[model samples]
Target: MAQGIRVLHVLGNTQLGGAESRVMDLYRHMDRERVRFDFLVHTEKEGHFDKEIKELGGQIFCVPRFRLYNFFSYRKAVKNFFEGHREFQAVQGHITSTASIYLPIAKKAGIPVTIAHARSAGVDKGIKGKMTRWMRRNLSKKADYLFTCSELAGISVFGEKAVREGKTIFIPNAIDCRLFAYNEKKRMELRRKLGIEDKYVIGHVGRFHYAKNHEYLLHIFAELCKKEKLNEDLKNKKSFVLLLLGEGSGMEGARALAEELGIADRVYFLGNRDNIYDYYQAMDYFVYPSRYEGLPGTMVEAQASGLKCVMSDTICREVAVTELVHTMDIRADAALWADYIRETADYQRKSHVEEMQKAGFDVNGQAERMMAFYENGNFDA
Candidate 1:
C-alpha cells in the first residue's frame, strides 16, 4: 500500500520545459511524507527528470501520444492504466489538449478529484494547432477543478466566463526563489569558466520551437552584434555572447541561422541544462521572445537572479512580478529589441527574491497548498 496521498500529474513528458521545471520545483519542495507526485507522461522514452523523480519515490507511467484517429485507443489506454493503478487521489491533467478525455475517465475510475490544468496560453501553428484547439474545446466541462497558470491561459482554454466568474484557480508558475537569488561569486566563477568574463552575455532559457521564437531571438542577437561592430568603445562582435539553454528539433535550424548571420562563434547552445539557475547568475541580461506563454517561470527566475529581461508582449503580464522585466512586441523589428537591451543592459543586478515571494511565485508556500488541494477539495479554503 502507498504511504502517502498520490497525486497523478499528466504531462507530455518530464522534460526540462517550463511546465515540467515548475512542477519539478514544486515536487522537490512539497512535503513528500504527506503528498507524493507520480507522472503519467505521453511519451515512452525516458525524460530528463525521470531519474530524479524515481529517486524521490514517485512512479512513472507512460501512454501513447493521442492523435484524433486514435481517440478511442487513447481512451482505452488511460482507462487501462487507471484500472490497474487506482491509487491516485487526484489526477491533475497538465496537457489540456487531452484533459477532456482523461479527466472524466479518472473520475469514473473512482478518483475523487480531477484537475484540468491549463499551462499554455497558446497552441502550435497549422493543423496540429487546430487539432489541439478542437480536442480541448470542452475541457472545462469534464474536470472537477480548473486550474490555470495565468488569466490569459484560463480565458483561452476555459473561456472568458470561467475566468471572469472566478471559477478557475490561478496557480502561478512558482520556483525556488532562493536557488535563483543573485550571487556575485557564482557569476564571476561561471563567467570565467565559460571564457566570457569580458563579454556581455545575453541569456535565454527555452527549447528551440516555433512558440519560443528562436529565429526572432537569433535575429535580435544578430542585430545586437551588428551594433557592437559599430561601437568604437564596445571593441568588436566578439564582446557579445549569446547563450541559449535548451534543446529541441529546432536546434539545428537555430544553429544554421546563427551561421548565416555570421555569429555562429558568438552563440553557445547549452542543451537541457541541470544547473539552469547558475547560468542565470552568470548572465548579464535575459531575453525571451516567445510567441506566447502561460506566465513563463523563466521570467520569474531571471528576475530572482537579478537579470534584466526583455520579454515578448504576447506573454501573460502576470509574469512581470518584478520591475526588471520589460515587454516589447514580437512583431517589432529586431533592431528595436537590440536597442532596448543595449540601453538597459548596464542596470545594477540585485536579487528580487522578496518581490517573487510576495507575488506568490515562490514554490515553498504553494507546495503546501497543493498538498492540501490533493487531500481536500477546497484547496483555497
Candidate 2:
C-alpha cells in the first residue's frame, strides 16, 4: 500500500526560507501514517528545521556539497547513498538551480519516481551563472516529473515550451494561514516585548541578499526617516524603524550599508526567529523590493496578518490573493517607496484567513493534496 511509503526530499540545508518554510508547513500538516518524509540535505550542520524534523520521525542524511570542482566525488557520494537506500518510494528535489546534477544520479540509481521542482524566478548573471544555467538545462531532462511554484518560475528553470506543453505541475507555496491571522493580543504583547510599542514598525522578512534588494530597501528607509523629520505633524514623534528578519551571505554587507547610510540604529536585524507569526502581528507595514520571485510565501503571511504590503512588480501577481498587497516597479526610486509607504501607513488590520483558504493556500488542504499526488504517482490532477 502507498500508506506507509516514504519520500525523500533533496535540497540545500533546511533553513528558514520561503522554500524551506513551505515544505515544513506541508510536513507538519501531512498525515504521518499515510506518508512519511526523509531529507537529504547538502550541509552537515543542523538546521532550524532539524530538531522538529527528527521529532516528527524523519531522518536527516547529508552529502558533500555539489560543486563543479568536485564533480566526480559528489556523483560517487550520491550514487552510494541512493544505492544503499533502495527503499525510498520517490525522490523529490527542490534545488531547481542545480537539480540537473542530482536528479540524474537518482534516475541512474533506479528510483521509480524522480521529481524536479522550481522555486525561484531569477538567477544570477555572469559566466558562472551561465554555466549553472547550461548545466540545469541539460541535466533537468532526467526527471520524470517537473514541479514549479509559478508559471514564470517554470519557464525560468524548464523552458517556456516545456511549460506550454503541460510538462510541469504547478504547486502553490502554501502555509498555515490561520496561525498568522490578525491577533491583537499577539500584536500588543510582541510590540511590548520588542520595545517598539509607540514606534511605526516597517517589517520585512527575507534574507539579506542582492536578489532581495536590501541596499535599495535601506535607501528607502533612510528617505522615510528624512521625510518623517520634515513632517510638521510628526516633529516630536520617533522615526519609523525598519525590522529586517532573516540572515544570509549578504548579512555583513547589508549591515555595513545600513551603517554607511546612517540608519544602522534605526534598523533591527532579527535573524531567523522561531515565532515569525508574532513578528508579522507586530508589524504595521510589510515592504519587499526584491529583484524577482517565483511566488513569495512571506507576502502571503504578511497579508494573512493584515499588514499593508508593498512589493516589487517583478514578483508573480499570483501571490496577491488578498487586497492588502500592492505592487510597484522595482526600478522606481527609493523616494517613491518612501512616499507610498508614508501614504499607506495607517491602514487597519483585518482577518484574511478565509481569503487565504479560498485561494487554495491553506497548508492542511495542500498537504492532503500532495499526499495524494505522492500515493498515485500521477500529476493528472
Candidate 3:
C-alpha cells in the first residue's frame, strides 16, 4: 500500500524561476503525512530543486522533452510512467502552455483530479508560441481543475470567458513572509560584510532574461549614475550599487551592457544565492522591470523585507500587497525610471509581514488550504 496520497506535478524543468520557487515554498510548508508531491520534470538533467525534493521525501520522475519529432516517445513515456505509478490522487501540470498534452494523458489513465495551472500572463512570440497556445486552449478541456496565479494568467491560458464564468480559480503565489521580514541589524551586518555601507543600493532578483528587461534596467541604472554624478549639492550622496541575483542565458548580455555603460564596478552579479533573504535586507530599493507576469513573487518578498520597490507597469496591480510598490510604464524612458528610482530610494524600511498575511499571501495559511484540498480530494468545495 502507498504511504499517502501523492500529487503529481509536471513542469518543463526545475529551474529557480518564480513559478518553481513559489511551488517549492508550498512544498516546504505542506503536511507530508496527508499530502505529498511528486514531480514529472521534462528535462533529464538535475535541477536546483532536485536534492531538496528528495530530502523532503518527494519522488522525481523524468520524461523526454516534448518535440514534434519525438512526439511518439513522449506520449509513450507519459503513458508508461502513469501506468506504473497508478497511485496519484491528482496530476497537476505547471507548464500551462503544454498542460493540454499531458493532462489529457493523465485523464485517459483514470487520474481523478487533473489540474491545469497557469503561472505566466504572456506567451512567447512567433509561430511556435501561437501553436502552443492553440494546443493548450484546445487540450485544457481535459483538466478537472483550472488554477492560475492571477486573473491575467487565467485569461491568458484558459480564455477570458472561462475566467469570467468562474471555471478558473485564482491562487496567490505565497511566500514565507517572516523569512523576508526587515531586520535592521541584518541590514547593517550584511552591508558591512559587502562593503556597501553608506551606499544607495538598488537590487533586483530574477533570471537575466528578455522578459526581465535587464538591459533596460542597466540603462536606467546608468542614467541614475550619470544624474548622481552631475548633482554635487545633494546631501549624503554616497556611492551607488546595483545588486543582481539569479542566472540565465541573458546573463552575458546584461554583464556586457553593464561593462559598456562603465558601471560594472558598482553592479554586483550574485548569481543563484542560498541566502536571498539576507540580500533583500541589504537592499535599499528593489527594481523589477519584467515585460509581463501573472504576479512576480519577488515583489512580495521585497515588500516583506521593507524595500521600496519600483516595478514596471506590466505586472498586475494585485501584487501591491503593501504601499511600497511603485509601478511605472515600461515604455517610459530610462531617465524617467532613474528619476523614479532616485526619488524613492530613501524611503524608510519596516516589516510588511503582517500586511502580506492580510493580503492572503502568507505561505502557512495557503499551504494548509492546499493540504485540505488534497486530503479532501476535491477543489470544487
Candidate 4:
C-alpha cells in the first residue's frame, strides 16, 4: 500500500496561473512522504509544471473540456474516472464551474473529502460567462468544504448565504514571500539590464485576458505620459515605460491598442516568464485594472516586493494585506488611474515578508494547515 495520502486537484491545466501557482506552492512545502498531490487537468497539452510534478512523484490525468451540448459525455468521463480510481483522499475542485457535477460523483465513489475551491469572483463575458455562472449555482451544496481565497470570491461563487452562515473557509492564495522580498541590488541590476534604469517603470503580471483590462491599462499609460508635473526626471516624453508581463489571446489586441493610443514605444510586452519575481524588483509601481479576481497572488507578490499597487475595486479588498494596495472603480477614467500611480510613485520601497506572513499569505504556515487536513481528513483552513 502506498504510504502517502493522495489528494487530487482539478484545474484547467498546470500552467502558470493564479490557482495553479498557489497549489504548487502548497505542494512544494508539504511533507511529501506523508502527503502527495495528483492533478486532473482539462487540457491534453503539457503544462509548465508537468515535468516538476512528475519529478516530485505525482500523477497527471486529463479530461476534455466540458460543454453544455456534451454534458452527458462529460459526466460519463468524470464518473468513469472516479469509479475506477479510488486512491484519492480528497478531490479539490479549483475549476468550480463543473464542481456541482464532479464533487458529488467523487463523494459517491468513496472519496472522503470534496472541496469546491473558488479561485475567481467573475467569469468571461457574454454566453460563456452566463453558462459558467449557471453551472456553478449548486457548487456549495455539492462539496463537503467550500474553500475560497477571498471574501468576494466566496460570496460570488458559493453564494452570500453560505458565506454568511460560516460554511465557507478563507484560504489565502499564499506564496513564498522570501522569493519576492525587495532587494535594492537586484533591483538596480535588473533595471540596468532592461535599459529602463533611468525611466519610471510601471508593471503588471497577468495574462492578457478580457478580465485583465489590458486596453484600459494602455489608456492609463497614455494618461501617465501626459502628466509631466508628476515627476521632474520622468517628465521627458520618453521617461515613463509600462512593462506588461504574461501572454494570452488579448496580447496582440493590447499591442495594437498601445499603437492606437500612441504609447507603443513606452509599452513592452515581456511575455510569460520564469523569473517573474525579479520584474517586481525592477518596477517602481504596479497597476492591475482587472474586471474581477479571486485573490490575485501578484498583489501579494507586489506587496512583498514593496511596490505600490493600484488595482480595480472589483478585486477583493482582502488582498490589501498592507497599505501598499489602493483601489479604483473600473468605471473610473484612465487619467484618474494615472494620477493615483503617479502620486504614489514617491514612496520608499522595502521588504514586506513580515507583513505577508502576519496576514497568513505566506506558504509555509498554510502548508502545515493543508497537510494536516489531507493526512487525516482534519479540516482547518
Give lDDT per model, in order.
0.89, 0.86, 0.86, 0.89
Q: Estimate TM-scores for all models.
A: 0.96, 0.96, 0.95, 0.96
Could you tell me the TM-score of candidate 3?
Answer: 0.95
Is candidate 2 or 4 superior in TM-score?
A: 4
Q: Candidate 2 lDDT (Cα, whole model)?
A: 0.86
Q: Candidate 3, overall lDDT?
A: 0.86
lDDT of 2 by residue, 1-381 (tens): 466778899989889877888888999998888889999999998898999999988999999987778888988898899888877778989876667777777777778888988888887767766866777785447689988899988888888988999998889999999899899999999889989888889999998766798888899999999898654443246569889999999999999999998899989999999899989988888999999788899988888888899999999988998888899987888999989888777656797888988898888888878888888975332
Q: Once superposed on the true structure, which residue ranges of model 2 sit more than 4 Å away at CA?
A: 230-238, 378-381
**Model 4: per-residue Cα lDDT over 143-176, one tens digit each:** 9999999989998899999999999989899999
Residue-by-residue lDDT tens digits, candidate 1, 262-315: 999999998987888899988988999999888888899999998989999999
- What's model 2's lDDT at 342? 84
| Cα displacement (Å) at residue 81, model 2 | 1.1
Candidate 1 clashing pairs? none
Cα-based lDDT at residue 344, candidate 3: 62
Taking the tens digit of each residue's C-alpha lDDT, what string does model 3 give over 1-381? 224778998988887888889889999998888789999999889899999999999989999888767878888988888888778989999887667778888878878889998888887667767876887776447689889989888888888888889998779999999999999999999999989988889899999867788999999899989998754443488667899999999999998999999999999998998779999999988989889888889998999988898999888888897889888988989999988777666655789999998998989999888887777844432
